[model samples]
Target: MTDLERDHSEPPDCLSIVSQVTNSTRAGKRERLAGAAVRVLHEQGVEKTTLADIARAADVPVGNVYYYFKTKDQLIEAAIEAHGHHLQTMLDELGRLAEPQDRLKALLRGWIGERDLTAQYGCPTGTLASELDKRDDGLDRAIAKVMGRLLAWVEEQFAAMGRTDAKELAVALFASYQGVALLTNTFRDPDLMATEGARLERWIDSLT
Candidate 1:
């Protein structure tokens, strides 16, 4: 795989190839499957997405999906992991800002940058967790950890700003993002992202 495709939540050495019967080529196949899973799941959602659909999208045989992912849930987990890697990469980039408040605002702006995609598919993480929650699957916990990383990062910023209520503030901030994302998707309005992002920046400035 190319450098563009190789980064994962776990170290490359530690990433598990989904197919139990490891072969020279299976690793590449697994990567393709995981990438395809993320895209298909985002576009099609959990209920409508199927292993066969992912396989077709990947240009692999339908049976190969079973070889890579015994169940759709396993594929979902891989997609979540891939998303975690992407989120952490973004957070790391934002962390380079000299000010914590700037970092927080940058994160919100980053979401705003995806306004088009968010309008089409919603917040990828939020939508995945919500759909999984409706199904009563345990996968929501995995998403919780992904979200917790963001909340904890945000809380750290608030705490650094000397807010004793940092944790509550973080939750409120995240809840706003979730709500905005829902409305943005439901109404298919990119303007909601711009409006909410502006409002969020104002709130961030008030964090002092």
Candidate 2:
């Protein structure tokens, strides 16, 4: 029998297939909405971005957004969690480098690679953290925790390099990065980020 005829004879689990497809579509919509929220929030700041803005960015209907995220705050929280997960994944990948100094340089390189975007929107995590800090709510604390994780990871790298002042070094590194990010955004100069990133890389080498 032909494949179509065999399928007709067998009568596949149509309900199961339909259920799986529906669930998959729901998951896709949610992920798209969350991703769009992150981009919009990063570019527009959380206070200025509305649910409709996110829906437009996601290509999901505004009504459908409520089906996934009940409120704007919910979407913001989801975006924060998404950023946290992404940060953890990046740190985990950087952790694979054999030399701690190489891992630090790799991070600077990764940031430099995104220089254009950073020039346009500022550092994604840093900008979000600064905006959320004004909220003085649970989200402020949530984003703070995300930044703290990054600081802790950098400190670990410095500690691994046999530096007794690992925490201080981590703070200084992040401060420099955040400062450069602000200036890059202010001037719309991606090259500035590249230059500063190289300087930071050299500084990292000097420490090692």
Candidate 3:
């Protein structure tokens, strides 16, 4: 029988109890698994991390992981989505500031300040996107959508500065940020990001 049919075959009262217990257990297990996956990805990166590693780190059976997440990519995608949402919220808060330049400055500062974490794990979404590019098209598209939103916001900031080619300028700024972030990750020093970020900000100020 199909999984859904099997699920529905249970007695109504038994099914209700099973559903509650299953949901509660699944919630706790998902949290642990997701947390373990994040730690593994942060430490070993998405390319090197394995299902066995995640299962061991989470103290769950390898089979149990499949019960929660259908595949490793699903787990990674969920983690990426969570991290992206966090960054989106932070960017939205920065976007709410009175002045566009101030908002841009805040973004720069925040980006540079992330060196503490980025120095170790790199940019979560960026790293995940790089790995996803090698694997699933759907995951890659989802990550691209998130990045597109950020790029659009940056373009809006550039437009506010009266830059005619806001889209191109925004792409340039993002490329610079990504390059510096990758460098910082490789070198294990936040200073590279700080130095380049300062230069970029100065250049932006000159444009205004």
Candidate 4:
């Protein structure tokens, strides 16, 4: 058999690769799958999205999805991981700002930047977390960690601003964003986020 053919004949590994996979190739496909999973799951939701849908979205073959993810849940978990990485990256970028309050307002503006997408599909993380919460499959915990990271970072910002009730303030801030995300999507109104996001920025300023 050709080297390429030989690669395909090997038994599937733990990640479900049925071929002899190079690290780079494997990582590339896995990244593609994770990225696709995030967008597809966000647009269609967890319960409604299929591996095939993800594959199509990723432009990967349907058979190849099984090579990277044994099940849809696994792909969903990968998407959550991607979301966490994205959240961390954003927070890290916001950290460059001089003030905690500026960081918090920037964070609000960042969400406002996604007003169109949020209005169409709801908050990507929020919608996915809500959908997964209906199941007992434990995926909710993974999403919770992503959320926990945001909450912790927000709490840290509030603490830096010298708020005694940092944790409670963090919760209230997230609650407002999440509530508006739901309303934005339900009403298909991008203005909901824009208006609420402005109010939130003002609220953050008031807290300072």
Q: How well does each candidate superpose onto the true structure, as a TM-score?
A: 0.85, 0.87, 0.78, 0.87
Once superposed on the true structure, which residue ranges of model 4 sit more than 4 Å away at CA? Answer: 1-27
Q: Report how far residue 179 has shifted in candidate 2, in Å.
A: 0.7
Candidate 4: lDDT of 129? Answer: 84
**lDDT ranking from best to worst?**
4, 2, 1, 3
What's the residue-level lDDT of 191 in candidate 1? 92
State which candidate has the highest lDDT.
4
Model 3 misplacement above 4 A: 1-28, 55-62
How would you encode candidate 2's per-residue C-alpha lDDT over 50-161 as one tens digit per residue? 8899999999888877766667787788888888989899999999999999999999999999999999999999999888888856888888899999999999999999
Clashing pairs in 1: none
Q: Write the per-residue lDDT of candidate 1 for residues 1-208, one digit (tens) a residue.
A: 3563454433242446543245554556666777888888888898998788888887789986666566778778888888888888988898899888898899899899999999999998889888888767778888888988978989998888889999999999889998999999999998999898999999999766
lDDT of 4 by residue, 94-194 (tens): 99999999999999999999999998999998998898899999899999999999999999999999999999999999999999999999999999999
TM-score of model 3 (CA atoms): 0.78
lDDT of 3 by residue, 1-208 (tens): 1354454323222334455465644445665677788778877878788988998998889887787777788887766666667778998899789888888888999888888788887877677768778874587887787888888999999899888999999999998988888888999998888899999889888888
Where does model 1 exceed 4 Å of error? Answer: 1-27
The TM-score of predicted model 1 comes to 0.85
Candidate 2 has what TM-score? 0.87
TM-score of 4: 0.87
